[model samples]
Target: MCAVSDDVQISVRKMDMRYRHETLLKDLNFDVHTQDVFVIMGESGCGKSTLLRHMIGLTRPRHGDIFYQGKSFWHCGPEQREEMMQHFGVMYQNGALWTSMTLVENVALPLKQFTTLTRRKIKHAVEFKLALVGLDGYGDYYPAELSGGMRKRAAIARAMALDPKILFFDEPSAGLDPINSKRLDELLLELRDNFGATIVVVTHELDSIFSIANNSIFIEPKVKSIIGRGNPKKLLETTDNPKIIEFLTRGERYE
Candidate 1:
């Protein structure tokens, strides 16, 4: 585990994200400090995942920039972008693993492609990553062979295969039961505490929001911008915006 640094690790500056001709978020600005559990949240049509895509360099915004450690994400050269990607570990909402491949093969893919580690070393690294995610002996199993929560854990192990500095999660609790969801939250906190990873999660689950998010940006679809930013708990307690309050409490008034 690396020691925490108070540096600003990620900055979304005046970004305007879009889908085809329709604008999604405009002039969106936020900062992710090192080791912070930052969340992107809002309603169903709010483009939360779209914003994450921009941050991961999958989509180019129509305006403004995203910065990681002082480098412009959209303006960087391909090589630079490739270098930046080495610092990222993304776990999709579905736990996107190939059905044909075993968990071992899946996790080993990154180490095999990115590093020149020997066969034995790669195996050890894969084992270590799987173990880290509490999947110690499930290497030979396929995605279908595991339970839903186990599959998510396996996907997480794959994401950690390269030991990324920033971990991005998209709706991590979407399909899990409350118990499993809580387990994932604990694992995320463990990653932040143990590996010092800066976590950015795109989610609308109130349980997850309260459990994991230290800071967050609530995307308002109608307004096409962030409606709320700060600690999730504080926003839930004190925000005057009806949309934000409705979101935090699921349409119930905050008492």
Candidate 2:
């Protein structure tokens, strides 16, 4: 575990999420601590990404509210909600970089939209962000020209453009080779260890769940709720839930 304090950065309280009038998750509750790499792990079709969408304000819950710093997100006014969202940075599964824009331009977009810095200052900031993600001289390259891993890193650089306090990633390792996935995991750890970022990642990758996560929640699709929570390794050793064990062990017998 990461020895985090009792500070809760994001809290999901009694949350119920649905798709097409079918409940996907009901009465969901969880807390993400400050500076912790919190992972949301589950099988496919478990609403892992759906819960993420709610956390990032892309969608509202059917029954409850999400709180950031103890302030209610769904109940807040638009201006306040926008202000709260400014503190979050999200990298979606597909990298989502604009194909027409160079890496510099893509990374610069957020700074340009959010800050009042001069063009010279924004250029400096953009370079610094790209370098932070190991894309130092590739700023001028288009997204299509880069490798899959590089494109994902570039997306991260853009996410960090405004230096958000909390970073949210949905299926970050979805399309990478094992080496690239490991490298990305290392980068995520670096961000948490060096920069004091509170990261929330939604992924089903077992390697990543064990390697990078200090805290986690496993969403059970059939039950439509979380069946397990806490450190992933500890959960593996202590949890008696067969479904959770099967998931953690890739459907193999744990004993």
| Per-candidate total of colliding backbone pairs | 0, 0
Q: Estimate, for each residue in 123-147, the C-alpha lDDT of model 2 and write its tens digit.
A: 9999998887778999999999999
The reply for model 2, stretches above 4 Å from the true place, is: 1-6
Task: Evaluate all candidate structures by whole-model CA lDDT and list the values in order.
Answer: 0.88, 0.89
Please list all clashing residue pairs in model 1, or write none if there are none.
none
Show where candidate 1 strays beyond 4 Å: 1-6
Native-referenced Cα lDDT, model 1: 0.88
